[model samples]
Target: MYQYDGFDQEFVRQRSAQFRDQVKRRLSGALSEAEFKPLRLMNGVYLELHAYLLRVAIPYGTLSSQQLKRLAMIGRKWDRGYGHFTTRQNIQFNWPKLEDIPDMLDSLAEVEMHAIQTSGACIRNVTADQFSGVAKDEIEDPRPWAEIIRQWSSLHPEFTFLPRKFKVSITGSSEDRAAIKVHDIGLALKKNDHGDIGFEVMVGGGQGRTPMLAQTIRDFLPKSEILPYLEAIMRVYNQFGRRDNKYKARIKILVHETGIEKLRSLVEAEYEALRASFIDLPQAEVSRIQNFFTAPPYQNLEDQEALLNQQAQQNTGFGQWLQANRTGHKQPGYAVVTISLKPIGGIPGDISSDQMDYVADLSERYGFGEIRVTHEQNLVLPDIRQDQLFDLYQDLVSQGLATANAGLISDIISCPGMDYCALATARSIPIAQALSRRFEDITSQQNIGPLKIKISGCINACGHHHVGHIGILGLERKGEEHYQLSLGGHAGFEASIGKIVGPSFKEHQIVDAVETVVQTYLDLRTEDEIFLDTYRRLGDTPFKEALYAAA
Candidate 1:
């Protein structure tokens, strides 16, 4: 993990001091609510349904055990006893008092974390794949580039206020686990035929009221030119992106209205002019940032396959967990383990202070002293030794953190809908909870196989509902909550937006509707086909017919 230098540390501390004075003035009636709105948003504070919400950035979803403990302590001291991990790889404290937030910011600064750029219409937190350096199929780690972008974009005077919020993601593997295609700017690191590394840059991908996949603005950009090229893209968007309507302000809308070809020409012209400017980062600076992400020391050990196999044979529970929650690691004798935050009928990403403390302890004890937050709303111990799996699993089970459902139907991604969000229309947590209970049987879930169910409370797409294998959107209709279902959506390579099946259902009928959709896939799928593949081959006819016929 990247430790904060003196510059970074001092920067955060000064920001905290500034915000503390602002908060004091607001409390003393020197600043009205309207006057304080933008100031509070710049510091990542939001007025939610019942109380203020504070979102803290977890850069590229990387956290040290020490940082994790501080977060747990802050949650315990200031607000409720738990915090919600969000889809953007950030954490939200939903019940903080207005007067206590400055203290929270100071506490976070002590741990090298902050709430800046988490809200308002500026560049948000830069996210990358959770399995970045450790995944077996990785080409290179993307976190270095993400960190470079983070340094460049933080409160840049030129882009302090854009037409709408922008997002950027990077991935270094052939498999796109970061959902790069759905971001405002997506970078896939690749090597050319000459064996030199560069980036495949895509722009204008987002999901809200309008869903669109990013288009390839540049087939290949040299690694040295990433920052300058990004500046060019931003310049183009700022000049042409809509400012009259918030609904049409995202870059995705601009790309749609202007067409990809014309947009590419405009961006290319800007890039040519900016190629000789100071925005082009030097290679030495890039290497300086890359040094922070070098691999941790590892002991040479043989693969623990024999011991793992024996343990699985001895315990059925261990066998199920190995099947569902474990993934292959780049190094032999090591494994990546996903700690399921979504226990059956539990909130998708809520972790209590006690649980966070325990996970932090285990990270130091059993694995490297590092933790990762996934876009799927789960925590990861990224470098667990295979020989110590049994002991870790035992302790995790004791803490109510061991649910052997990582990619199954029970591992749902849901937003804080009407329960906490002021912009939501319906309750997303209950719908997700009901669906989890409906599929609680382990055997049935394994049978269904590799399904993603993403639910959003409204059309803001905070839950990433547009990319799930089975997407559910909750809408308000005539004073009642109605749910709509969509199919064939996915977030990996060749990302596609889901298509709606038909009419909306009442709240009580959604679980059954999802079951019908799953059953239809099971009936129509060929050998070893997943839900998305089956839907693509057969189209929506079968699932739609089954859903409507039963209704």
Candidate 2:
């Protein structure tokens, strides 16, 4: 985790104080509802159907034990006794009073966390791979660069009022765990033939009413030009991006309207100017920032394959968990573990104070004293030792955090929906919950294989439905909640936009519709093919036929 310096500390303090005065004015009725709306949004406070909602940025999902404890404290003292982790790797408090937000923010600042730029039209938190530094496939640590971007974009005066919200994502590995292709700007760190690390830049990628997989603007951008290059791209988007329609305001629309060649040329020209200006980042500064992300201390341990397999043979539950939760780490003995936020009947990403403390303890005792939040709304202890995995699994199991359903059907990415959102058109969480209940079996899930089932209450894509392997978008038609389905979408290395399949289904028929689609995939797929693979190979005809065969 990046420690806050004196400047960072002072910045947060002042920002909190500023929001405090704003809240006071709003509460006293000195500020009109019209005047207070934008102010409240700027502070990450929203007026939902039930109460107020506050979103706190996690800075690429890295948190210290103290930080998690602070979140626990906030949840327990101010509002509800829990916080919901969101798909963007952020956490939202559901019942915070309008007046206590400033104080809540003050507590967050104490732990170097805040709700700044979490909502309203600005560059949101820059996300990176959850297993950034520890993942075995990574070429470099992406968080330091993500943090650099976070600092650079924080309250940036120029971009604060862009046509619409902008999102940026970076991944240090080839696997694209951060879903970079579904962001306004996506960056991939890689080493060229000469063994020098640089970035592969993709622009105009995002998910919403109009979802798109960003095109590669620059195949290889040198490490020295990252900031200047990024500045150039954003400048182009800001200047030429549409604003008349909110749906058409994202950079994706700009890249879509103007051909990729023209957009690339514009960005390159802007880059030429920024390279010679204030945005030019020097090598020493980059190294200075990068040094903070040093590897965790670890004792060299040889392969414990025999012991691990033996343990697995004895405990079927442990074996199932190890198969789903444990992933390879770059370090010899360390492994990355995904702590499922979706416990059996629990809310998708809600974590209690005790659970947060338990996670912190596990991170310190078993893995390194570091934790990460995944975009799929889950916690991660990235450097857990293979030797300690069984014990940690037992503890996680006891805490109800060991649901072995990562990338499976039940691990659905869902928004708070009409339950807590002001922009929602339908209730998303209930639909997700119902579907989760319908498909709770691990064997059924594994047999169905790696699938992304994302649902959004509206076209806002808060749940990233556009990228789901099986996408479900809830809409209100004639005062009824109807769901529209999409197939073959992906967000990883081979990103693609999903195609819609005909008419919307009634609320009760949605689960059956999705099951029908799954059955279609199972029937059409070759022995080893996944849903996306089969769709890519044969196109949408078969799925469409299966969905509308009786229509």
Candidate 3:
């Protein structure tokens, strides 16, 4: 939770005022729709399939109670009574009127939030692990670096308009919760053999019409050089990345066309030049930013192992939630509670205004008055005391926020497909909902184990379908919605893109197809093997055969 300083405040205010004027001109016909299109996009407003969608960035997916409440208010006041959280860990107001967006932006500014860089072909939101500082396994918190990038990239004149959009994701832990490998630039924070912190820098990782995992450009870059090196990479891309074709404009394409060795050489040369110009961030400035992400105070209490075991014996529901929705925290007697938004047959990541307000209240009372949005489209109370788990679960259950399926088969990651996005080729939400219902049994889900089902409506891969254990990509075959299945995709320390199984299935047949694939894995899997591990061991032959057997 980096609070906005005076400079930050004033900058947002001026930007808001400028946007307000731009919007006014567009509405008054002083600016034509053609001229207003890019301007509105730069501010995170999009003309969607049925209405305007306003995407608000939740920086590194962190939110204070006040910020969460403000998002709830914006959802209630400007658009429909709910907002759609996306795979990028941002929230989207799906029904906002064009005229009301400026007001929405102003309201967001008041909460140190905004829609800037959430859309268009500029540096988008810099994301990190939702459990950054709280994760027990993390080497260092990654948000400070993410924040540094956010500040540097925000309206940077040099990178204001690139050939294509760029994304950067960071992870502080060995586990790749942030999916760093699939970003335009991925930074993994780690300690070297000498106990000095640095980054494992990867570049050219992306998914779209073409999917490729990022390759390591530097094994261990000194922490002090992150910004300058990033600038160098961007400079290389901006100067040489293709501008003639939108389809191939991304840096991923540039990296593909030019080998990683050459790209690394180019970036290193640029970095060497920039490092001499006093452009690297000073150690003092880095320390100042790092101070904001320091851990919160916690009472020295005994571990909750016995208490949790006792509670599990008493309440079946709380027991299930605790098993699936909780992750160990850095502090003893505390846990990071994931509030799953993907309830069976519910719209994935769609939180109603009332639910948002209640969660905000719960964050203040039970946690640290802070919330986190995960890339998997869930909310997290990162600092919840283990002693209060029962009470929090009951409250979340009442609000329809307790699903007990955080990383289970039912916890699907999906995008707003043809239902909202004009770029989508098919419907994604209904597919997600159907699959959730198909696997609604909690026992069955637990039996299936940590399965990730990510769906995208098209090849743009907004749902991160490329990285799911069982990836589903929705496309229109002829005139009907069809889903093409993929297997063995994973997003972790060992990241890999899923491989296509066989022909696409029709909309109605997709649920059954997924079940067939899962059942195949269950039959063939060794003891304790999850869907991904089984797939990796067995490959696509078994799943593909089972998937097309019914056809």
Candidate 4:
């Protein structure tokens, strides 16, 4: 992880001091609540339902062991004994006193972390694949670029107060674990014919009251022009994006309203005119940032295929876990391990302070002394030794983190919903819980194959329901909670927005509807076809027909 430089240290210090004074003024009655609301929001403090929620950005979801320990300490000393990991790969504190926010910021700054840009209508945390550095298919680690964006967008005078919030996600892998297609700006790293690494920029993708897949603004942009290109896109949106109506404000809306070709032209015009004037990013600066993420050294250990096979023969549970949680790594013998936070009936991404400390310790003991938060709302011990997999698995099991459902149907990604969110219309956690409980059988879940069941309390799509294989959007109908199902949405290499199947279902019927879809897929799939493949091949006709069938 990147250590904070002098400039970084000073910036955070000054900001914290300024915010401390701001808090004092607000408490002393000099700054009224009305005047203080925006200031607090800009500092990443929000007056959420029931209490104040402070969202702290874990940039690119990479954190050092010390940082993790600091988080554990924060959770232990303050508000709640746990923190909620969000789909954007950030962490949130559900209960923080309003008066103590400045002190909280100071503590975060001690670890080179902060709440800046985690809230309000500005560029939010830059997210990326959880296994950015270790993914076997990655052309290059995306964190250096993500860090650059963090510094560039931090308190940017031009964009700090935009019409609406903006989010950017990047991925260096071919598999697209970062869900780049569903973000305001998505960057996919690629190598052209000449074998030079760069990015394929996707613009105008988002999910909210309206959802639209991003379109390629540039098929390939050289590494040097990334910042300039991003500036161009932001400039275009800030100038012309709708401000009169909040619903029509995202870059996605503007792209749809003006047509992608026109939007592309406008961004290009901005790029051409402003590229020269933009600050020249130093190569050494990028290299300095890259130094923080250089791959760790590993001994040339022999592959453990035979040992793993023997263990699998001895324990079916271990075999199931290996199949679900283990992922290929670029190194010869290490594996990327996803510790599922979504245990049956447990909160989607809430990890207790003790669990956080344990995870941090485990990362140092078995994996690298580093951790990552995925867009799916899971944590990753990205550089685990292959030989120690079983021990690590056992440790995780003790904490109920060993769910063995990484990409399986039971491992659903859901938001806080009506339980904690002020904007929610229905309860998402209970629905997620019911569905996961229904699919508790690992064999059945694996038999059903790779399925993403994402749920959101509202159209904001915080849970990324718009891209799930089976998307569930909760809504209220006539004072009763209901869920509308969407089928065939994908957030992989071939990204597509999920479409609503038909009418919404009652809260009780929603889980049944999901089961119906799964059973329908099991029957309809030809052979080894996942839910997504089957849905795309046959379209929604079969599934929709099956879903609405009388029980």
Backbone N/Cα/C clashes per model: 0, 0, 0, 0
Candidate 1 local lDDT, 1-551, one digit each (tens):
78889999999999999999999999999999999998899889999999999999998899999999999999999978899999989999999998999999999999999998998888889999999899999988999999999988888777868899999999998799889999999999998999988999999999998989999999899888888888889989888999999989999999999999999999999989987765557778788889999987877777898899899999988878888999889988899999999999999999999999999999999888999999899999999999999999999999999899999999999999999999999999999999999999877898899999999999999999999999999999999999989888899768999999999999999999999999888899899998889999999998888988765
Best by lDDT: 1
> After TM-score superposition, what is the CA distance of residue 27 in candidate 4 from its true location, in Å?
1.5
The whole-model C-alpha lDDT of candidate 3 against the native structure comes to 0.91
TM-scores of all candidate predictions against the true structure? 0.98, 0.97, 0.99, 0.98
Backbone clashes in model 4: 0
Clashes counted in candidate 1 amount to 0
Model 1 stretches astray by more than 4 angstroms:
none
Q: Model 2: per-residue lDDT, tens digit, 1-551?
A: 68888999999999999999998998898999889988878778888888989999998989988898889899999976889999888899999998889889999999999999988888998889999988888898888889889998998887888888889999998799999999999999999999999899998888888888988999999877787787788788888999899889999999999989999999888887776666565667677778888887888987677888999999977877888888898888778899988765456888998898889888888976888999999999988889999999999989888899887888888888888888899888888888888888877878888888888899988888888888889999889999989888888988877778889998999999988888988998899888889889998888888888877
Clash pairs (backbone) in predicted model 4: none
Off by over 4 Å in 3: none
| Runs off by more than 4 Å, candidate 4 | none
Candidate 2 local distance difference test against the native: 0.87
Evaluate residue 351 in candidate 1 and report its C-alpha lDDT on the 0 to 100 scale: 99
How would you order the candidates by lDDT, starting with the best?
Answer: 1, 3, 4, 2
The better candidate by lDDT, 2 or 3, is 3
TM-score of 4: 0.98
